[model samples]
Target: MKSKITVMLVDDHAVVRAGHRMLLSQYENISVVAETARGEEAYQRYIEIHPGIVVMDINLPGMGGLASIRRIHGRDPYARILAFSVHDEPLYVTRALEAGAKGYVTKSSAPEILVEAIIRLAQGDTFVDPEIAQRMVVQTVTGTDPSSLLATLSAREFDIFRLLVNGRTTREIAEELCLGYKTVANYATQIKSKLNVRTTAEMTCLAYQYGVLNG
Candidate 1:
């Protein structure tokens, strides 16, 4: 018999983790090998277990999922990650993919969709929730979506940008990201310059306009 595919679950909620475990357990071909509640721990666990697939949440306790995905994919180029996030916004999807996730699925998706995404990613295929995929395609064709401009930001820059728009101060962002104050401040300035925004208000306005932050 073929060996089952191993999966690692990374989310901050124990309840969510338990629900996922129950859902995935019904499949004979997939097994939950490990779980972690923080992004930093996710990378550590990934290195140790080397699970066949990683189901990661975007809003993690430490470093955040985008950072974790970047770290894991940076170390192991073949790492297969499925981003399971509450964020249905196109910006989050774009940044998650940019950060090296093999697939993106919203939390609101049916359980079957998540299972199908995991199987597809395990098979080296990319998957995106159909609604998000269609919206992205429409945006691309209409040339009206702000995602093209947002895509210019690197993974780290994008993370900083999101925090900045959410009213996270430089010091707070630095602390949350575990970066030096000066470095985060500099990134803030650079991000503003890249986005051609003069102030945090402008940044917030742009974020709201693009659905980066729900109004």
Candidate 2:
């Protein structure tokens, strides 16, 4: 017998969540148990509902989805999170994976892609959109030259690296991640030492060249 799949929705838009709920309702094999707009609530709901799949958006208004996914996965490594977002850019996709997301699907995808992501998650497989997957493979081989330059960075260092390359100031990253300005500044120093990059602009240039930002 095919067991029904339980899904939890985490998107900031009410109408978008409603639309997903309505669409998933058409499939007898899937159930939408809970929905949340904030990252904190999504984390709470995941624990309470223990849904088979979690469809989340990356750019939540509060706390952010990618960070939430990392926290949730830390608590429950078995949790299945499929990032469904309008941001199909490689940076978004790569960050989601580093943060422990199991699947990545763009919101602009056809309905079948959504269905396929859910099914793949249900079967305990990682899912990435075809375009994203191919890009990742090529980057994995060619991205090593400069991308691996940061191999020694800690998780926090990597976070700082990404934000810096994207032109976020230390003050800005601190505010976004809820850390004190000095705290983020400290992370910047650590990242530079680990990556051997002397300046933020230099790191940004390298990040672009190695497809860390482009991918």
Candidate 3:
């Protein structure tokens, strides 16, 4: 008999997790072994469970998914993570891959794609959503890097950048990210300098231009 592939699901929404759990349960060779709502808890749970694969969301509250992927990969270089996100922008896909995710799948993908991604990751293969793959190819061919400024920001800086562009106040971001006010201020300054935007409005504009913002 083939051993079932164990998976850890990390998402903020309870209903979403439940739905995925049910969906994955339909497969005889796959099982969800653990679940978490916060990105900060993902690495810890991974350490405790050591599941075969981790399915993570990118826009998690607190440490955020990218940071969690980095931490897990730092601890276990061989760890396999599949980044599942609603953000289909190539920037998000690129960042997730750079963070050590073995695969990237958009939430809008067909349900079967999620199963295919999980199975592929379990077998030590990479999977990317077809839509994202096409976009990445176009970007590569055009030589137009939509994530130029985003690529320059370090992981921490990128975390702060997302919050800032989403209209979070410095204090609010500091509190949510558990950074000192001065630390967040310093990161904000660095992010602005790297992006070459003097104001938050400009930053928001850049995010919109790059398709970071949904609307």
Considering lDDT, which of the candidate structures 2 and 3 is the better prediction for this target? 3
Mind giving the per-residue lDDT tens digits that candidate 1 earns over 157-213? 888888888878899989989999999989888888888999989989888877776
The deviation in Å at residue 154 for candidate 2 is 4.3
Which pairs clash in model 1?
none
Model 3 quality (TM-score)? 0.95
What are the candidates' C-alpha RMSDs?
1.8, 3.5, 1.5
Residue-level lDDT tens digits of model 3 in 50-132: 99999999888878888889989999989889998989888888888899999999889999999999999889899999888
Winner by TM-score = 3
lDDT of 2 by residue, 1-215 (tens): 78899999999899999999998999999999999998898999888979999998876754677788998999899999998777665656767888889999988888888988998999999999988788767777787433456656666666667678877788878877899998888888888777778998888887777655521
- TM-score winner, 1 or 2: 1
Q: What's the lDDT for all of these models? A: 0.89, 0.82, 0.89
For model 3, give the 10-residue run with minimal summed lDDT: 206-215
Q: How far is candidate 3 from the true structure (C-alpha RMSD, Å)?
A: 1.5
C-alpha lDDT of residue 144 in model 3: 85
Q: Rank the candidates by lDDT, best first.
A: 3, 1, 2
Question: Where does model 2 exceed 4 Å of error?
Answer: 89-91, 141-154, 158-172, 191-215
